[model samples]
Target: MPLTITIPQEYGYVLLCSTATFILSNWHAMRVGSFRKSAQIPFPNHFATPEQIAAASGDRKEAMHIFNCAQRAHYNFLENYVSFLPALLIAGLKFPVSAAITGAVWSVFRIVYAVGYTKKNTPNGKGRIAGLYFWPTQLVLYGLAGYTAYSLL
Candidate 1:
């Protein structure tokens, strides 16, 4: 067997899509850093404690909520990445173009979800519209991976 593995040509499409995906995740991280600064949430503390929230003024409360949203948006991407990366890998091996296109769509909606989620008064639950649309692309990636696996068997 050859020591070096061959890279598939279509893997480039997967790489580009993965790049877009990570850029979105990192952008959220940068946003969280800025929000943390605005909220005066120092390092070693992920977020304001309940007591701190209770004692905060109106402006501080608003800042805290924004920071919380930024943190949640970034963490939410991390949660999804667990599945996205693996599924992208499995599906890309067999269907790179389709996988890449869907991945791009997924990344775009995640941006929409993050933007909406970071809006103030999110307790109203109106910010989940983008989240609602996020599942289909993910399911498709999973479906492709599943189909690939089944075909190989």
Candidate 2:
């Protein structure tokens, strides 16, 4: 007898969430690249060193802020995505419906985080507060997904 698995509707939602996260990551990276170009940051052999990045934004406070924010947003996504992707995959496979919902929620949090980080002059400390609120929620979701997968093994 062949082993069989049934995919649930929520799996599609998880996929959509994953795609949205990817798009957000790409947008941050593009923003960084655009800032670098606009600032005339020289890229030696298409790669920027720390020194090069510093030099590129030299004496320009706003330019440095933009570059730092963009870089932070991009790197933050990359760091989180490494853990999120595997957790999402395992959760979607093991507990599709709940995992997918969690994944979607996490994605929304991530978007908020990115936007908060990138946008200028958000009122009432909204941006920072948004990120602070969502980050732990996302981490909890990842932990739950991981634990669920581990329990199944």
Candidate 3:
């Protein structure tokens, strides 16, 4: 017997948000790769060391600084994405529409966050501002997850 699993139609929004996030994630990685080459940071190293930076063919200081920021931005997206995906899927089990809306909000703000981060060279830059709005959305997803869990009990 072939068994079929039924998913909620509202889940479509989650998938859309997920796709957008994937695109954003890919862009961040590509930016990192491009900057890494310009910065001449080697395969195993996340940032260019002093000697490596000094030897780079481009504007050494700016190239290294930009590459470092790109790398950090890419990794930061991955860090949050991992947790968000599982929580979103779980929350969708009971509140698909709500989960998707919150997820979409997060994905949108993530772009702002990443763009701000990549554009600014500082450790804490304007990118952090967008993140403040994302927290409330994440909290809503968590609340939905709790509802789903309680329903399953």
Candidate 4:
């Protein structure tokens, strides 16, 4: 579609956030493989796919579980962020600074969440703890985006 909004500054922030998430998400995915290769542990021969290599070598059901958790959390991050983009675009046009800051905050929280989640070996309260960082980021984006949507209508 033709351009409907203009906010280069906010767009840049949003794009940067998206790029950061992409890098972090892919890195986590690769770490799943890397952890397997270095595990020196073994799994049943049946578990020999590229994905299974990590699980097998590490004998780390916990690590495997963490990776799965990360995948889901990152997916949720993407889901919420993308959902807010349209609202952000509109919001940025009107409240560029707020929107940009919100986007930046969102990216930061996601990165922190990934770091905290990945470093730990188990999935006890770590996920919940890291999520504290993640939620505000999402909330900021949603708040700003909502404001923009409201202003546009």
- TM per candidate comes to 0.88, 0.70, 0.80, 0.62
Residue runs of model 1 more than 4 Å from their true location after superposition: 1-8
**Candidate 3 residue-wise lDDT, 5-34, digit = tens:** 457888877777777778888888888899
Model 1 error, position 33 (Å): 0.4
Which prediction has the highest lDDT against the true structure? 1
What TM-score would you give candidate 1 relative to the actual structure? 0.88
Per-residue alpha-carbon lDDT of candidate 1 for residues 18-84, written as tens digits (9 for 90 to 100): 9877788789889999889988999978876767777898988778877877787788889988998
Alpha-carbon deviation at 107 in model 3, angstroms: 0.9
Candidates 1 and 4, the one with greater lDDT: 1
For every model in order, what is the number of clashing pairs?
Answer: 0, 0, 0, 1
Q: Which stretches in model 3 have alpha-carbon errors above 4 Å?
A: 1-6, 50-58, 120-126
Per-residue error at 131 for model 2, in Å? 1.6
**10 residues in a row with least lDDT, candidate 1:** 1-10
RMSD (CA, angstroms), candidate 3: 3.8
Model 3 CA lDDT for position 96: 81
Clashing pairs in 1: none
Candidate 3 has an lDDT of 0.76
CA lDDT, candidate 1, residue 67: 82
Q: Rank the candidates by TM-score, best first.
A: 1, 3, 2, 4
lDDT of model 1 at position 45: 85
Off by over 4 Å in 2: 1-5, 44-59, 121-129
